[model samples]
Target: MKSVHMDVHALLDAGVIERRAAGFILPYDAVHVDFFLKAG
Candidate 1:
């Protein structure tokens, strides 16, 4: 099995996410996403 710690550490260093007492978070209060779907 592959260990994800290395990758997780990279993300942590990049400020893309933050760590909490319980776990990691995306560091944003809220996220807004837009989806475009092409209906056939």
Candidate 2:
């Protein structure tokens, strides 16, 4: 879970996905969040 969060954070910082208040929400055409989870 921590790794997923870290990956999501990195993605957001890299402009891969848009940041959100509740959680790491992906952009309209961005890849699925599952990618991040599995990446972790």
Candidate 3:
């Protein structure tokens, strides 16, 4: 889960994805991530 977060964060830092397009949540000891990308 940590690795996933790191990957997403890297994309955000690199401007590959918008801030609103990436996020994560933990529910019931689980990691949940949701990302939205603009369509061409």
Candidate 4:
């Protein structure tokens, strides 16, 4: 689970996603991976 958190942090740093109170939320839908990746 630590690795997953690391990856999520990387994604947020890359501007691929944003962190929220609920969890990670994708800002755009241009990429296919974001749709399948759930923020928890």
lDDT tens per residue, model 3, 5-40: 899888667656555435543223554569899999
Worst 10 residues of 4 by lDDT: 29-38
Which should have the higher TM-score, number 2 or number 4?
4
The global C-alpha lDDT for each of the candidates, from Candidate 1 onward, is 0.83, 0.73, 0.64, 0.85
Give the count of colliding residue pairs in each prediction. 0, 0, 0, 0
Measured against the true structure, the TM-scores of the candidates, in listed sequence, are: 0.57, 0.48, 0.46, 0.61
How well does candidate 3 match the true structure in TM-score terms?
0.46
Candidate with the greatest TM-score versus the true structure = 4
In candidate 2, which residue pairs get closer than 3 Å at backbone N, Cα or C atoms, i.e. clash?
A: none
Better of 2 and 3 by TM-score: 2
Clashes of 1: 0
> Considering summed lDDT, which 10 consecutive residues are worst modelled in model 3?
20-29
Residue range 1-40, candidate 2, lDDT tens digits: 9998898788788888776788666667646555334553
Q: Give the Å shift of residue 40 in candidate 4.
A: 31
lDDT of 1 by residue, 1-40 (tens): 1458888888799887789998999978886668899989
Query: What is the clash tally of candidate 3?
Result: 0
RMSD of each: 6.0, 5.8, 11.0, 8.0
Off by over 4 Å in 2: 20-25, 28-40
